[model samples]
Target chain A: MMSARKIIETIDIRKIYGMGEVSVAALDGVSIDIEEGEFVAIMGPSGSGKSTLMHILGCLSRPTSGQYLLDGEDVSRLNKVELAAIRNRKLGFIFQSYNLLTRTTALRNVTLPMVYDRTKEFTPEESDEKASRILEHVGLGERAHHQPHELSGGQQQRVAIARALVNDPVLLIADEPTGNLDSQSGEEIMTLLHRLHQEGATIVMVTHDSEISAHTQRTIHLLDGRVETVVKNGKKKPGKEKVEK
Target chain B: MKPIEAIRIAWEAIAKNKIRSFLTMLGIIIGVAAVIIMVGISAGTEAAIQEQITSLGSNLVFVQSSFTRGRPGQGPQSGGLVFDDSTAIQDEVEGVTAVVVEQYSSETVRVGDVTLEEVEILGTTTGFPSVRDIDIAEGRYFYDLEIERKQKVAVLGSSLAKELFNNESPIGKYITVGSTKLTVIGVLKEKGMVGNTDYDSRVYLPISVVFQKFTPSFFARIMGDSVRMIYVELDEDANLDSVITQIELLLAKRHGVSLEEADFTVTTQQDIIETQESTTAAFRSLLAWVAGVSLIVGGIGIMNIMLVSVTERTREIGIRQAVGATPNDIRIQFLTEALLLSIVGGLIGIVLGVGGAYIFSAFSGMRTVIMVHSILLAFGSAAIVGAFFGYYPANQAAQLDPIDALRYE
Candidate 1:
């Protein structure tokens, strides 16, 4: 029997920058498959080609040579407009910088994906209601009317997370979601991600910190445009458990 | 995105930068105002010209003989109207009001010790004043009996009276035109200048006497004996074309020429007025073109400012694109902003330009005529300019790469 699940399968994805003598390969034959309801972290150092891969997965950029299948449909060959539709419907994004429109309220930011999707017409009241509900889910119900600038770094990141989740997309791809926050704010954001994962959200986050990777159930380590290793069910060792406590 | 949301976003964006938006709209304001003001002034001048022409007289016709066969510019050769044609016009034309034959000659006139140099002496019958709509200020004009009996009587223009007689009542006095002496029977009421020619510096006399007394030898040069030009007045109810055709046929037979070779030019006052109106309309259109060019320059200014705005708002565009705004939305937002600016500016300009035109008419003593059609044209052109000039920058804003835009500072 076929399973009704959202899955991303990338086959030998290769992305290159520039050409001729100045050729630089950003992604070199990297392939990974993320199953439904999985919380996976892509960990890599600077210049590890992880962001390029993330950009391709998020539908922001097309891979130079690859087949990216979202739920078994080949999205790699789709046009820009079609890809935009897929991004609107199937993928949600969280950025480290909490990319909210500076002049708009938190509710307006959350309603943006629905606006792009061209779904059921949402009046201002309807958009506000949905945004408030999503904000409530993210523990930010009280800050619905506030602008990004008015919120703390952790709160702003949560707002970004709420905006991403408002569309109820199949995959949440976060690019360095906690990179710009303080350690405590980062921990709170990670806890929120963990709670979202437990609520059956499929998350794929990119981070450079190994400590942050420990929170996720699985970690994919990338080095020099290649996946180095994949660790599944990364529980703490008996000797390291005492130190973590 | 919905159009309402797009409009709201555009409005909000413009509202956020109120000073910039207003400054950008200033170009459209000045352009619309210039077009309206220029058109208004031209219309006013045309109205003034029409008024002046109408004041001269309506349905009054002038016939001047063309010297070179049918060609108009061949000096004044005679084979034209005779004194008998004036009588024939009154007798033959059904709507003929009055007929006055005139022969003009320049001569010096003297009264007492004062001499007026180079004064125009008009030779016509006593019915000239009534036919030409001139009135007497003092004494009385010559009677019909005086004109039939070849009496040497003159009616002095107001300026001529003032120059020769000063403040004294010169009724029953005599003035000498060249070697011919004439009695000053009346002083004409002051008639101001017409088309910059001083009408109030002329004298009038009987046509029979002027021809018999002065320049009797001049008639030997032309075929047939006649007055130089015939001024005819038609009844208000008469069809001008019928009269003109009848007069043309009669004059052709009288002159003993074929229909094509009839030496006289007959025209009605309506012809002169129409010609003046068309000429003024041409001038008005030329002025409108100049004003329209300025509007184009103003539109260019709008385009330039919009381009700058697109550059300045690159990041905002990127943010919108990132969040799901299509390129079409970006284009519409900027275009709508431009249209709104131009529409508001155009309305303001119309008010100001119309008000300015009225003020000019009052202060400068010129007739101002503003037509609704011209106002509509000015406003419509302003909107078109807004759309045409606003399109490129809006398209550029729409075509910006979302990735590059998001990274824009």
Candidate 2:
């Protein structure tokens, strides 16, 4: 079977640092396409350009030269303000550290993206209701009022996930979503990602762990600022590993 | 981001660090309070001085001998003001209503068993009561006939009357001054202290009686009928400058001197008030400037604390940026926090300053007039300072790179 539409299409994207004397290429001659309903992983060792690719895809940083198409819209040459608007309306991000604001309740953390929603798609009260409902979907309804310090690592990551999905973004970009969690919490998070994938949500995750990559439909492997292989996993399996607490 | 959301976020950040925020606001509080209190006191003193000078009398002019201030033992010179000048101003000047001339002396007085030392005795004409705004409390003042006939008549000031004869009336009582005994016909009303002069402690007598009884100085014998000062009162509709010019010209002719070499100086009540007001205005501005410096220091304190907060919350800012907050939004958030701190501090200072003024006035017995403009100025400057000093740090926070900020420790 073939997907009807491509959610992300990049063409030979490169990110260079320092213009004079000695220059460095963080991303070099790498291009990939992600289908509308696919769960994909980008895996690489340190300095392999996986992080730079993630930053460019997440719209947190612009590539030095490339054409980045998000949902059929070219966004590579957009300015900072336009990029921020695109990020707000179409993309959601999950960091390795579960960067939930400290001293803020889980519900407020979930509602934060909507605060910067310039379109004003929802009133403040509607935003609260929508955030509350999403919190319930992520099994964090009971911990909605708890601050980040009051929640465990897995719960904080769940809050972050709920926040990412609150605006109903077209793509979810998760970078090492389970890196900070224990083995059981990591497995639970993988199961949640699988469920979301089964519900026809597009996900792009960046991680170095092969076991975590096994859970996705496809994996893009990077070595030395370029993609080395694109592996299509045959089927999903219940892979379990006893990670250190 | 919406401004309301930005303000809410700013408020949350400020509330999280309540102690630090309050400490930062302390500078603004003291600065505003100092400004209000200083301006209030200066304004009160100015008002009090105006009231005292106006109380002397309305539409009044004082003509004094140029040499009267310095030449003490010399008494009256040839060019000194004589009693005849008062008559000429009253007759020749068109708008003049009353003229009173006075010569002062200090003498011991005795009434029955009570003896008061160094009582101020004023030898004045009949129009002294109207010209000086003094009224009789119990009995009448001496008439022009009494001065012309050289009658031994005296009027005791209210306080002197009270001192000489406790609760009893001093009307018709006899008081001995030097070797002569004069009958007290009237007691002057109680007028409170103005500057250093105590109107109620004085004794008023007919000028003729003083000239006949008191021994003449060597210069007084040569300059016959020379009085100390002449007070002229004009009608309500009179032009003060024109009347002053008329009296100046008439006096210059009588003293047989050129207009530029006139012996007497003429000054109206308005001139004295203007001079005193300009001095106080300068004093008031100086106090305001000193207070303004403290406000600027307070603004610097806000900038310092805001910079520290920006540095401390770098990661939070990065997260916000990742979540789609624009640089403009970040700038507005921090700017709102700074403005809130100063505005709240300014409001508190206003309350404390007004209350402090009243408390000070009660304890120290000094008048303090809390002007509305002073409060507005303090508050306005506080807001401006917050915005002015807050811009740099807010821009610094806005210029932070999200990638580096997220990775910061």
- Quick one: best TM-score, which candidate? 2
Looking at candidate 1, what is the lDDT of residue B251? 77
Name the regions of candidate 1 deviating beyond 4 angstroms. Answer: A1-4, A17-24, A71-73, A105-107, A132-159, A182-195, A232-245, B51-58, B64-96, B101-230, B235-265
> Could you report the DockQ of all the candidates, in the order they appear?
0.33, 0.70
In model 2, what lDDT does residue A123 have? Answer: 79
Report the C-alpha lDDT of model 2 over A10-81, residue by residue, as the tens digit. Answer: 999999989877889988988999988888999999999999999999898999998999999999999888
**Could you tell me the TM-score of chain A in candidate 2?**
0.94
* Model 2 ranges with Cα > 4 A deviation: A236-245, B67-84, B105-123, B145-166, B172-184, B205-216, B224-228, B236-239, B254-257
Candidate 1: residue B104 lDDT (0-100): 80
Q: B192-305 in candidate 2: lDDT tens per residue?
A: 787678989988999987777773656556556778799998899998889999998998787766667667889888888999999999999999999999999999999999
Q: Indicate which candidate wins on DockQ.
A: 2
